[model samples]
Target: MKARFPDRAKLRAQVWNAMDNNPGTRMPAFGKYQALSEAEIDAIVDYLYTL
Candidate 1:
């Protein structure tokens, strides 16, 4: 399963971009997360690995 996302940096960027820009019609934009720092985003990515 972990092989699905081998690049942490790319995954982080995807997460950031998704939040920065609306991904699609159904997924709401998480623009509010723009206030979060890079470290915070990294933490979020790290936490995601646990799931």
Candidate 2:
């Protein structure tokens, strides 16, 4: 979710935090992503930034 926003690091951190918090159906639970490693998460974040 690319936005006109300036802080990619902050945005990335928010995503990571949300994943850790597991906020139910409001977003996907991070546990479903246990198979993914930190590098995979970084790659996903990088791709989102390109949008």
Candidate 3:
């Protein structure tokens, strides 16, 4: 099967952007998450790799 997120860096960027920007209809903008730092976001991305 095709991969959901083939590029980790791209995925991280998308996630960070989604925090303030609306990605799509399925998910709403999570502006509150903007408080998270780049390191925190990287940690999140690292966790996602496990899934």
Instruction: Assess candidate 1 and give its TM-score to the true structure.
Output: 0.58
Query: Clash pairs of candidate 3?
Result: none
Model 3 segments more than 4 A misplaced: 19-33
Q: Which stretches of candidate 1 lie over 4 Å from their true place?
A: 19-33
- Candidate 2 minimal-lDDT segment of 10 residues: 23-32
lDDT of 1 by residue, 1-51 (tens): 147668776667656666433446453323335656777778888987777
What lDDT does each candidate get? 0.62, 0.60, 0.62
Q: Point to the candidate with the largest TM-score.
A: 3
TM-score of each: 0.58, 0.50, 0.60
> Model 3: per-residue lDDT, tens digit, 1-51?
017778786677666665333445354232235657778778878888888
Which of candidates 1 and 2 is the stronger one according to TM-score? 1
- C-alpha displacement of 42 in model 1, angstroms? 0.5
